[model samples]
Target: MTEDQVLDEFRAAEALLEGHFILSSGLRSPRYLQCARVLMDPRRAARLTDALAATLPAELKIDAVVSPAMGGVIAGHEMGRSLGVPAMFLERPTGTFELRRGFRLEPGTRVLMMEDVVTTGLSSREAMKAIAAAGGTVVAAAALVDRSNGKAEFDVPFYPLIRLDVPSYAADALPPELAAIPAVKPGSRAIA
Candidate 1:
């Protein structure tokens, strides 16, 4: 689908939010995309995941799809379905990502890390560590939206259906207009 179409889907689901908000990265931004809202619709989620799957290297063999918990769960599942592989998520029970709940990746298992959006990409980086610890090799990473504007990076391939340059600011450097509004924490993680 086109970028406009993808944005239309987000807007239709009211997932494209605007206001003073805190992101998982702890950076403040006036715009936020509550991807969970868009993914709530199975059809919409499938559409996006399918698009993401299409971007994968045709020669790449994926043994499983893994994602970090909370945000990446749904997108990972949908991507797994599209790729015909098992999908599992990492949990942060001890303040670090881990492969829990019988989730195991055999040594040399090829993995595709999936996420809803790639902003600062800290979560994806953390997920990679867990994947490596489990002996899984991440061949590539995929996401529905890349709000990092090409700033985020991964050791392997990174793909997204959309690339958006959403503006973000440090806590003390927020724009006066955004600072005037009461900042809301809409993400799953706590502001750090």
Candidate 2:
């Protein structure tokens, strides 16, 4: 799908939006892309998954789709279905993402790590580590929206369906509109 088309769909789904948001990157932003809004629509979610699936090379065989839990679950499932692979999700346990609920990656399993949104790529990194520790080989990383604009660090090749170059503000760098808003740190691990 064209970039404009994808963005249009995002807007249509009211997923990409603006507000006081604490991104998963520990950065404060006035805008937030609530990906669940888009993923909630099966057809729209499939369209995005199809687009993301196109980026994978035919030679790179993916055994399963693994994503960090909460937001990435549905997207990962859809992507896995599109690629004809099994889907798994990692949930946080004691400040770290681990394969819980009897989920195990067989040795030498080729895994693709996915996220609903990529800001600092923290969750994706943790998911990669867990997969690696479980003896799974991470082939690539994918997300529905990559707000990092390619600045985020990752060992594997990162792929995002929609790259939004939206501006972000730190606690002190917040805009006047957000000046009165309560501060919330952004990071993959949200300490409730």
**Highest TM-score among the candidates is held by which one?**
1
- Estimate the TM-score for candidate 1: 0.98
| Number of the top lDDT candidate | 1
Off by over 4 Å in 1: none
lDDT of each: 0.92, 0.84
Q: Which runs of model 2 end up more than 4 angstroms from their true locations? A: 180-192
lDDT score, candidate 2: 0.84
- Reference-based TM-score of each model: 0.98, 0.91
- Candidate 1 per-residue lDDT, tens place, 86-176, comes to 9999999989999999999999999999999888989999999999999999999999999987889899988898999999999999888
Clashes of each: 0, 2
- Candidate 1 at 112: error in angstroms? 0.4
lDDT of 2 by residue, 69-174 (tens): 8889999999998899999998877777788898899999999898888887777888899889888999899998898867778888888887888777766787
